[model samples]
Target: MILEPFPPALPYDFVFKLARDSHDLEGYHKLRREIFCEEQHVFETDDRDLFDESAMPIVCKSLIAGMEDTVVGVVRIDERSSGLWYGSRLGVSSGFRRLRHISPGVAVRNLQPCYAALGALGAGLIYKAVSTACALGCHEFLATVQQQNARFFQRLHWQPLENIMLHGLPHVLMRADLNHYAAAKKVA
Candidate 1:
């Protein structure tokens, strides 16, 4: 697929913040269904989960639209004493996915490049957990990188520690030391 150059400002909808509440939760579920269930074939999707009560949400907006713009992205973070562990079913519906990506709530790509971007930007639902981890002086972050996605994280400097089965998929235990990331100069 040819990648179109999306305007940065327009893509950002000129703002960033937490999801309002259960009010837009339907949209949130819709986006997740498109990516995690329909596109990647991840879960059978029972539609009920432990995180529903505690997870934080963040959304991206497209300026062309009105205030509610679009839910371009999302992430759910699980905070832990060892580190901040993050995961979520997310969709980059416009740039990637290719239409078929929004199939339903049972087939979709399990992993992608956006996770690291979410961590870096302090955006997405996962951003809050990342910040909380940082506040706790967390030096490292860990997650079960999908087997197919292990190479992607490796490219981003996350190191794999073990290959294991998680949620019916093979995943490599991966770690990211935020200290190294902090020392790197941000691109202008």
Candidate 2:
């Protein structure tokens, strides 16, 4: 009898936290470049800017068998001034973006799922960054999100502030309601 090769193991668990070391930070940047520069063509070479110098990078790591494997998602938060914080460069690895959940009996080959679901990987990354910023004393949190993603942010309790053009693409200036993120201080 012929035996088929087993599919590669998929991560069934994930953890969202601050980038703990250089490796995590590097993965964050690499994922951002993949989504922003290569895939979306938002930036010709790199998406990095001066804000990256002071931004606190948060990462969602996929775990296999209780061990951390890769950064599947990332977002950065930076305090622009006293009580004012901004989030940017949110990205999820293409391979992991469609995963709603992983479990036994779920066919790995058919992993396509909507990322806008409440507990999806991208939502977790955004929540982590916003909560962390709130914990750091952010009274007002803002982000310039791509037009297509504005509704996603809205569902997360972010209010649209205005419209603007950035990197030659339409974007929405949105603000996160701090009340929704107040629990971060307790967890922090």
Model 1 TM-score relative to the real fold: 0.60
The lDDT per prediction is 0.49, 0.78
Clashing pairs in 2: none
Task: Give the distance in Å from residue 57's predicted Cα in candidate 1 to where it truly belongs.
Answer: 2.4
lDDT of 1 by residue, 45-129 (tens): 6443786666555444333443456665655545554655554443455453222212121111111113333232222223333
Choose the strongest candidate by lDDT.
Answer: 2
Per-candidate TM-score against the hidden true structure: 0.60, 0.85
- Tens digits of per-residue lDDT for model 2, 1-188: 99999976668677677886999888888888889999999998899899988888888787776677788888889999998999998888888777766543221221222233454777777777777777778889999999999998998889999999998999999999877764463332
Give the poorly placed runs of model 1, Cα more than 4 Å off: 1-16, 46-48, 65-68, 82-84, 97-132, 135-137, 180-188
Global lDDT of model 1: 0.49
**Candidate 2 segments exceeding 4 Å error:** 1-9, 102-116, 185-188
What local lDDT does model 1 show for residue 31? Answer: 72
